[model samples]
Target: MSLKAQLQDEQKAAMRAKDKQRLGTLRMLMAAVKQREVDERIELDDEQVLAIIVKQVKQRKDAAEQFIAAERQDLADVELAEITVLEEFLPKPLSEEEISELISAAISQSGAAGMQDMGKVMGVLKPQVQGRADMGAISAAVRKQLA
Candidate 1:
């Protein structure tokens, strides 16, 4: 089944199980997905949905950080919980060794000779790593390799 279908199934389960938090989070997710589809006037595929999910996860993390800094642990915990639910739908995170290998391959494929070619390498790496690895970590790896 597709990601959208999976989300629908989870939504039903959440409803049946009386999982208020899960249901609310899933509904918010569906809203975001539907919003994008409506705005763009096209149905989203798994890849597009994944992009939306990634964006939502990032927003949650940022909110959690802000909440923590403000000494509101309760709000921060909620954001963290939402992140856990959102991540369940994402692909398995890439291990360090796998990321390193991909970076090396990207660098070589892009013929990146130094820092000047960082963009080219990153351009090649982004699509392969999207939703799988943190772009910040990937950038650091690419920088280290170039150095």
Candidate 2:
């Protein structure tokens, strides 16, 4: 089934189970997906949906960090729960070693001699590793490799 279909099924299950928190999160996700499709006039494949989920997960992680720093454990826990739900839809992530290897390959392929060529290296890496790794971390690794 497509992502849309799967989401609908899960939404129904959440509703039946009276899982208000889970249902609310899933509805928000579905709305985001629908908004993208409606605005862009393009259907989202699994990869596209995964990309959205990854973005949402990253935002939750960032929010959780802020909440923790502010001593708001309740809010932080909620964000973490949402992250767990979002991650369930993502493909298995790459290990740190695997990410470094891919970055090494991208650097070599792009002949990125230094930070000047960082954009070029990233251009190559984005499509290959999108939704598979923490891009901020990958970027740091790329910068380190070039420097």
- Give me the candidate number with maximum TM-score: 1
The segments of candidate 2 whose C-alpha lies over 4 angstroms from its true place after superposition are: none
Pairs of residues clashing in candidate 2: none
Cα-based TM-score, every candidate: 0.95, 0.89
Which digits, one per residue and each the tens of the lDDT, describe model 1 over residues 46-95? 98999889999999999999999999999999999999999999999999
Candidate 1 global TM-score: 0.95
Candidate 1: regions farther than 4 A off: none
By lDDT, the best candidate is 1
Each candidate's lDDT (Cα)? 0.95, 0.91
